[model samples]
Target: MSDAVEGGARRRGRDETEEERADRMWQELIQEVRVAQMGVQILFGFLLTVVFTEKYDDLTNTDQTIYLVTVVLGACATGALIGPVSLHRIVSGRRVKPQAVRLASRLTLLGLALLLATTTASLLLILRVATHNGFVPYLVAGVVGWYLLCWLVLPLWTRYRHTSE
Candidate 1:
């Protein structure tokens, strides 16, 4: 057990070996991934079914292209979100939980970024189809801004603001 410093202060709950820290981080990351994975899976499933709907054929060429891109992004995001489980299963009993946790965290972050892009693309397609307004892009951008604020900015802000000066 040892103290770890961050921004000049010893981080709380730092009294753990590498393995124990990795185990704790793995548990926490899995819990977080569960929520995100479910959302991505559900969204990807819905996207998969959209092509079979009768209304899909009425989409403009541009809209169809956007839909295609959105669906691909959704699939990629789902893969990244679900990657940690597969990674863990394969790496189990290999004495690599710490490295595994690091890689899984990276995958989760990439998944989140992809999810954000997919959501933005989906909203743009839907709003364009529904309203056909010139302002659709702006509206979609605003929603993306809101998502960024909620998902990343607030957390980063809290982390920065609370850190020792």
Candidate 2:
């Protein structure tokens, strides 16, 4: 085992060299990104089609603004989620897999955060249009809370609790 692998080893099962660890992590990260990417793409596509609808013309100015912002956020999330592929393609065979993986991971996290915001805004817009109820904000807030719990809080908790210090 390399000294670096033995010294600051954080993996659960086996000690691995930095390159090996990076490769494994890259694969795992790509898998996660794939799942997230699919959802975001679908959501973004749906958002794109809304602008052409007759109901879009009847929307209040405020609602239109919200829809525009949501669409922008969805676009950003899509870009961020798809960034890793471009990063990999540009840096292929450069012996920078570790750095690439780290950057890609960061991008994926940012993408997910944006996706959460986009979904919240989309939900709020849809609910407002559908019901015009005062409870739309509350409903969106509840769903956002659920998303935070499932996507961010639980993952961090698991990492903190299970990983060695």
Candidate 3:
């Protein structure tokens, strides 16, 4: 029989240590979070300003409710997207980069879901108010389908197609 270290065990390709993997994953996670953070921040800022606009008073009760829901969803998305930064700050120098990256990834995913809801609600409210047509819901549904295709379906497809067990 050959030696355990040299023979039967499968050899890793690059022999990338855990620390190196964590470092690379953290960098990629941070870059992804940055893109999400910018978008959520801008959308949240715009949502906040809407209530102070002159047209705010003219909104019907249903539209106002939709606006409120949209704003709240946006706020939650903002919090979730920003969570990774705070997490990193608190966990810095703890040698738990892998755990941190996993947690941050979860938060980012939650933020994206909230963002999807916020965008859908905002679109529904705006289109209803603008068009006053029976087809508003249909239009909103179409847009939501598009968002799903872009945000969830494609990622999942790529993951399943390319990833190995």
lDDT of 2 by residue, 1-165 (tens): 223345677434647789998899999999999999999999999999999999999999999999999999999999999999999999989999999999999999999999999999999999999999999999999999999999989999999998666
Q: Candidate 2 at 74: error in angstroms?
A: 0.6
After superposition, candidate 3 runs with Cα above 4 Å error = 1-14
Instruction: Kindly list the per-residue Cα lDDT of model 3 for residues 65-143, writing each as its tens digit.
Output: 9999999999999999999999999999998998998998999999999989988998898899899899999999999
- Candidate 3 accuracy as lDDT: 0.90
Where does model 2 exceed 4 Å of error? 1-12
Q: How does each model score on TM-score?
A: 0.91, 0.92, 0.90
Cα RMSD (Å) per model? 3.2, 3.4, 4.2
**If the candidates were sorted by their TM-score against the true structure, best first, what order would they fall in?**
2, 1, 3
What C-alpha root-mean-square deviation, in Å, does candidate 2 show against the real structure? 3.4
Better lDDT candidate (2, 3): 2
Point to the candidate with the largest TM-score: 2
RMSD of 3: 4.2
